[model samples]
Target: MDIIRTISKGTDLGGKDPDHIVELCNEVVQEGHSVLIFCSSRKGCESTARHISKFLKKFSVNPQNDDNEFSSIISALDALRRSPAGLDPILEETLPSGVAYHHAGLTVEEREVVETCYRKGLVRVLTATSTLAAGVNLPARRVIFRQPRIGRDFIDGTRYKQMAGRAGRTGIDSKGESILICRPEEIKRIVGLLNESCPPLNSCLSEDKNGMTHAILEVVAGGIVQTANDIHRYVRCTLLNSTKPFQDVVKSAQDSLRWLCHRKFLEWNEDTKLYSTSPLGRAAFGSSLSPDESLVILLQFFITLIIFEATAFNLVEILLLL
Candidate 1:
């Protein structure tokens, strides 16, 4: 039995009361539940974590040390427990119980530590950037969105939907709760965005002109295609989906494939409707083999040109030349 509570028409508390957020945080902790507080910036994460730590001190936790070298979430928590110093200008205090900050810039190992702490119930609250909504599965009993409105037009609906989605966890809590603190006028849009169903954005191939050109050149360099029909068959069978009829997409794929064929990276057969990679193409693909590698050797061969150009010219110049 999950309940979705919408707090409509409320005062904007963006910078108003640190105590209100801290109090709600303490309430969640007292019930032995974890909470997630989403903030806009890295500095905001540090600031919110600090403010909550002050109110948390009564629960017997010390503040974090400014000089302490904290590389991971576990280390940060440990440092907070060991140090007895006051809060930093940005960070208020350590979680009187347990809490941590999560963001992208931190190393993968550090993010793992934060995730581990939340799952183990060692960290009662996590103040993090919106990135947590996508890749990680760390769920909280309560999710507090500190940002009610994003400025960008394209982000309005999609961004709010993602932040609101974090409210519910399937296994841990029977139900989940999300709180959005905002001015009264903004509530309807927030609620509407949360309730509406929007299709996921379609994935598009990179439009980097130079990268596309290089990809074509690599195919040519490998000596693959001998005829225009071979090039057309390759594009039709491998690159462009037969089901979808987007002329632009088909044209792009055809052009790029033709360039590869002309460069000799692949040899094309009209009758068999097959394009085979050449000797140079095979060696290039296997030159730096790894089980986890993403692109095939031919694609990598094409990418090298873009990389080389990037090194030689500034991005603006490269774009202009491309």
Candidate 2:
């Protein structure tokens, strides 16, 4: 997706001025096209939507036709009122002007109403958090980023592409455009992001993320791995091994195995140099529990069992002493 770059004299936090954003939406809506504005936070989404809605209402832009027998905007408003969240005050103000914001902070019912309205063209301008880009199919003629960052950190290439992809729906719009509102100091960074390639794929089983512990436990418990040699062989074939140094991969695997043994999740025979899953490990593997999860569950179970035994046997005094 191609981005039409724009610079802004922004706030201290580096986001574009909300008034400028409202005017941009005004221009897009006047041309009879929908616009999607991506904001960094849920609060930002609501604030930006309020700004655009007020502007649209003041100028009577994109107003719903009068005397419609069944107006979707009215229907959406009714739906929100009946919902558990009871017509979000922001939505109550904005939906009448064909504007709304979407984010996780809204109840499921609220988000559904906003999404349906936008899709049916009842809502002309939508402001939303970055999650809307990744999770929803709502597209627009023009996509605008209120800020380059989703939160405090700058958005990466993949996320930018995801949000930008929402522009220019396949059959509806003949052309799609993406605009990034950045401060002067951020121009170089934004340009680099526009040119950056997607980051390389990494294994979910990488030790750095603690996935190695789960992987090693599963293999050994399932009898797929028998010894340290078998672990080294297994490690050599994984995606983690491909990206990391051979020695590092083996060391990580060995460390995970040792950890499992130390936690009594696995047993190792010094003479045979073989590894086997303990009863706890077998139970954990069978239940599809992670090593840490299994430990917590076991501890909780034993605590409950001890309490029950003490109470049933009338040994509360002895229990306390021990």
Candidate 3:
């Protein structure tokens, strides 16, 4: 697969021309190839897609006066026809063509619909968050990254290698093109990272196995376990095999359980020999209720309402008034 990596350091599109990116995307789409643009977050992805869509629409309708007119009006019209009807009423009214937004915040059915459209070649461009990078196998002829840095840290040489690796799909494209929009300095760094070989993948299997083992002993000791004991037992019996020193494993597990109890992450009852959820433990287990929510609930339970004027009244003054 052919990979093309571009770098831009400018933080905002206003600093650099957005039309250049949109034009490149149009060119790729006109060649009957799909494109995927990655942004940092859901909001960023949506905003970028919206901006690009507006530019594309303006380009398609007024091609001569317009800067971006690689694709014909007919193609744009076709794209509009294939767009999701569930979009906001205003957006549905003024439908744009050849582009769509995809992210996790969208409903499962909505995501599935976008995937189906993209796979069928009905949708030419997809702008999404990096969530699509790891799991989904969607192959785009061209992949554009608006921002390559992960969070506050500048993407180091190693990170650049991983991001670039997502470019080429094994069998889909003869060569895949990956583009990164960054400043001139960042571009140089990316080039250096690309020249070096990527490091070997780190294995987390050992850590996960140890964690499961610890969880099992914690459950038996009547302490809260992050995951269910049945899951750990299944992993140990079926996947890990009983090859390790059982006594040592048991001792480590017990130690971990005791530590958890001491930390108030879990509570231990010697008499009942059963693990019960503490207030903190319940908050941890219940996905619907967050720690903040639990705190709010507790506060509401203990605190009674007071009149605004009560603060001005001393104990003797309040008693005299009563």
Candidate 4:
């Protein structure tokens, strides 16, 4: 794995810089390999894909109409039009030029269309959000970080490494280049990050309060660990015990149990000397909602029952909120 920084003069880029990106992508794809371009936002990804498709149109007069190897991509796009996402006309035209974009704003089927098109080489250039870097296993010959930021915040070294890891296509490419596209001024910081060693790992259970609370609730609710001692024993048999101190894990588990009890998510079984989940708490375990989040939602449900009459608007609004 190699990390290289590409410093470009005209990179003070606004939305119009997709043209420059498409040119770079063209050079990479010409080598008979795919290019994955990472954009900071969904809008940026769409813009880049448009520029790529437009640029490719200049070189090939009838790229889309040709009997392309990946015929599935055309059918996939047609299927996407039926999806509730209401396919963009630009996207409809761009995929045929062997270029597309993927982002959360696109529905699951729409994103699937882009992924399928790219994987099958129907789409040579794909511009996508950080979701492509982290969520998907799709790799390309060249992975371009158009910017060092994902969304509002600038990415850190750890995230940048994960993105870079997607550069090399395994089995096909012997070596991978992790290219960081940044301004000339930012070169030193980028290089410094590359040179530095990664930091030691820490358990999120000890750090993320919301996650810890939810996990603890699951344990009691699922009957995984009934008591504080059971919680400690469970933690001891896990990988976290290797890095974290034993007593600390037990203490944290105890604290979490107490918090859950206070939240009314867990009931103390005095006779059994154990903790169990209440109905409201068990409901949280079965949901995507965190323990704290579910508690707020549950309390609100009770409050609404007491405070308001089941009027049409109120009922609709409450259901919508859920």
Candidate 5:
């Protein structure tokens, strides 16, 4: 990754300059190289892709310009048209120029088309959110960071390495290059991060993160843990248990189970002294909803039902108001 050359558009700028990013991408594409731009959010990806496409439109900078019929582009368009998402308006405008955005916000069909075209080297300039860093194997000759962040917070060494690693792939390119756009004041921090090793991995099931509740819910819903002893046994094998005292782990597990039961996600049998997932619990697990989220959904559902029964308003009207 290249970090020595810091381009300054003006003094006192807080973030990346779009003009510089566009110019840099244009130069890379004009040189017959594919580039990937990492954006912080889905909206950022879309906007950056559009900006690059517009800037490159003035000149014949597209690497794929030699294809008169744009056969690959046409095939991609056909696939999107036939899929449920149809042809996205932004994609319809940008894909012809070998540019597109990839993010979770796009439908499965849309993401498939973008991934297929980009992998085949049809789409030269691709913009995507940080999720793309680890989700797919589509590498590029050059990778550019619109900003040195995944969101408001600066990226850590591990994330930086993951995104930068995509710049060059074995048997794909002669060399790989990555560029991170940051303010002049951030150069030192960025350099330190580049030189530093990744931090040690840690468990996210702590009380503050609230992952334990979800974890306990999954096991119970899946019938993996049926009784209190089973719950304790499962907890004993967790990383959380290794880090915390056994009694503490047991207490947390009990709290999670109490919360789940109170939420109608679990039922206890006094006769057999066993625990089982309730219908609501199974529904929550199947939908992958967290405990708090499921509670909110359940409340909303009941409120909607009450509104439907107490008034003459149609379901659509009640939904719109809610």
Candidate 6:
């Protein structure tokens, strides 16, 4: 994936920005290549898509665009247009030229429709949030990142790799190209990132799992919460779980509890159906660790010992279970 750092107008001077973005996209897209642009938010995604679609439409004509491909795209959009309030004004105008935007704010059905068209090669240009970058396996000839930060958090190297990985379609694309439209200030960092290799995957279960585990322990230890219900209440206050139903949140907590018990970090009393942290659990808690992470570290250490002393395949069996 090619990471292109846009100069002058992109980030250093704010107002003249995005217009230059549209201009750049115009130059790339008109050459018959599709571009997937990742904006910072859902609103930015919508706005960017609309802006580019409008500019492209001056050269776009209905009922004829050289083939039947566009006709299929229009029909897909028309179905949305005819439903309820129909397509948004932005989508209604843009979809005619095989362009659209995607983000989490839209309904599942709405997202499915847009994604289907893009996959069918009916949608040529797409503006989307980083959600699209991580959630699906959609590839485009070119990827243009309009911003480095999404909301308050900067996109990290792992995420950059994940998003850029969407660039080339296997067999279909000779090679995928990705562009990072950043200010001159961000150029060095972005270039340094390009030279680095990706580290091993850490299954960060929804934004700082280890941190959340420690926070939850703090809440419990501080006497702020005495029951699973209280734990669920606080967890629901978090951004990741805020929109999730309380029942779902509680179920997840319960699963974590069971996992802790299985890890020998917590004791579950069958007769009373009560749960309490064991010595290991308390030790892990004091050190700011989740039972799962602690188990992983312990396993790694044990494997090292076994590599020098043990003759049994116990480590292999344990790894298989994990």
Tell me the whole-model lDDT of each prediction, alpha carbons only: 0.60, 0.83, 0.57, 0.75, 0.83, 0.70
Candidate 3 runs further than 4 Å off: 1-19, 57-96, 157-163, 207-322
Q: Across residues 241-302, which tens digit of lDDT does each residue of candidate 2 receive? A: 88889899898888888899999999999998889999989999999999999999999999
Which stretches of candidate 1 lie above 4 Å from their native place? Answer: 1-19, 57-96, 150-155, 200-322
- Flag regions of model 6 displaced more than 4 Å: 1-19, 57-67, 82-85, 202-322
Instruction: After the best TM-score superposition of candidate 3, give how far the Cα of residue 77 lies from its true spot, in angstroms.
Output: 15
User: By the TM-score metric, which is better: model 2 or model 5?
Assistant: 2
As for candidate 2, its clashing pairs are none
Residue pairs with backbone atoms closer than 3 Å in model 5 (clashes): none
lDDT of 6 at 277: 68
Location of the lowest summed lDDT over 10 successive residues in candidate 6: 10-19
Candidates ranked, most accurate by lDDT first: 2, 5, 4, 6, 1, 3
On a 0 to 100 scale, what is the lDDT of residue 190 in model 2? Answer: 90
RMSD of 2: 9.5
Residue 229 lDDT, candidate 3, scale 0-100: 52
Winning candidate number (TM-score): 4
**lDDT of candidate 6 at residue 31, scale 0 to 100:** 61
Model 2 TM-score, 2 decimals: 0.61
RMSD (CA, Å), candidate 6 to true, equals 19.7
> Any residue pairs clashing in model 4, and if so which?
none
Model 3, range 1-322, lDDT digits (tens) per residue?
2454443544242234553677767677666787788777777767766666665523233346233332333344444445563444322322245566777776665566567666756566788776676677678888887786654556666655555555567777777887777876676776775677767543222334445333443343343343445334534543223545554444555555555556454666677554555666455445444333445665675564344345546776978989
Report the number of clashing residue pairs per model.
17, 0, 12, 0, 0, 1
- The TM-score measured for candidate 5 stands at 0.59
Better of 4 and 5 by TM-score: 4
Reference-based TM-score, model 3: 0.51
